[model samples]
Target: MRQALRQLAGRVWWYPHDEDPDNIQGGVAVISDPAGSVVVDAGNSPSTARRIQAAIEAAGLPAARRLIYTHHHWDHVWGACAWPEVEIIGHRAGARILEVEAQRSWSHHYLRAEVEANPRLGPSFRGRAWAMPSWEGFTVVPPHTEFDDDLTLPGGVEVRHVGGQHAEDSTVVAVPDAGVLLLGDCFYSPPLHLRQAGDGYAADLVDRLMSEYPEGRYDWFVDSHSPPRSRQSLRDLIVSG
Candidate 1:
């Protein structure tokens, strides 16, 4: 699918998630600043990352200076190789996870073997392993800078670690000046592959998000897999879900 770069608010632009493709991917956000753009998530593969880069360039946005990872999932971080010049950043725990993932072989055969041996290696893994155009030079680049709680980048972009059921290293990025908050899967329930029988939302994390960034605090709530939502809409979905 030809995904266009859509502006979320002021200087924030995002490439929406694509579920139509065999290799489903998550949304990627870009916070444009004079210093350089701050990108959220590298992408699912080199091709995906390049597409993101192309979109940014096409929009006349600044080149990416820093890549912020919401977590160390393949769909979110494996595309780092495409942006070799950008400084990568993420949660310390997420950095540790990527460090371990970096050592694993990404060869098609190896990935297939892994999925067969462990079902938890789920559809996400299977799709990336078999559907992406090429894994010939696949690489995993962990964050160069790590933070435990939260960090603010140049131009008032805030990244906060909000550990949850989706991924323990999950985080949400806020461009307060623009009234935009990018919730990188932090609000989602654990994927079926990783879920226990009664696994549900991480109550503490949900409470934190609700209270810390309540309605009116951010005009747009951008989730990795969904379209941007109104602050109240997200709150309602979270509460009802």
Candidate 2:
């Protein structure tokens, strides 16, 4: 956990779901520049939302301006209920996750209480669940603002919708001047543990984003898991792919 925190600069932060280790991961980022800072993804609990809010405040950014839903997974969007004022953003494919998969994942967990009771769901995340993001009883809101491709995104910073990787709505939010590109789970490091997301991941999305990220041009690369990578390494992953 400390290593993950160290990976992100002071400007970004995250909150973990104290459940089975592999259960859910919460990530949120802040970019307090011109276009304005934005929260990349909401976590599982209101405390997580509050932590993200605290991180944003610590970074000296606004309380609420933009909220980005990398994907509509339960852990990613469930906590947004904590901040109803923020404008949510995501790709159309992600919108479907809200409308469809969000509940499915929850039902899978809720209905599988026996599976969870049997053995903590797995050896890795095995433990008494503390605060897993439960959509079991909450409102699921669709992305208020949806873009297909190449959007004039906001975050107190200007970002371009680079290309698709995670899902059809997957977009690489790039702050050109900062050279900081938020690769929304495009390259899931083993550290960013999860089963899978609709048959996407590994080198597929990572390779695509790297190919389009101006090639050996970015100054910083941020993902939910792998911390930040220098331009050389960022391009190398793509080049190697």
Candidate closest to the true structure, highest lDDT? 1
- Write candidate 2's Cα lDDT for 77-192 as tens digits: 76777777878887787787787744544433543564567543443232113344353445567788887765665433444454443444545666665556776665543222
Please report the candidate that would top TM-score against the real structure.
1
| Candidate 1 lDDT (Cα, 0 to 1) | 0.84
Superposed by TM-score, candidate 2 places the C-alpha of residue 199 at a distance from the truth, in angstroms, of 8.9
- The sequence of per-residue lDDT tens digits that candidate 1 reaches over residues 1-241 is 5677988789999898987656668899999998999999988888889999999999999999999999888889888989999999999999888888989877877877887889787677777774466877777898999999989887888889888889899989988888888888896788767778877656567667767876676788888887788877776776777
TM-score of 2: 0.68
Please state the error at residue 221 of candidate 1 in Å: 1.3
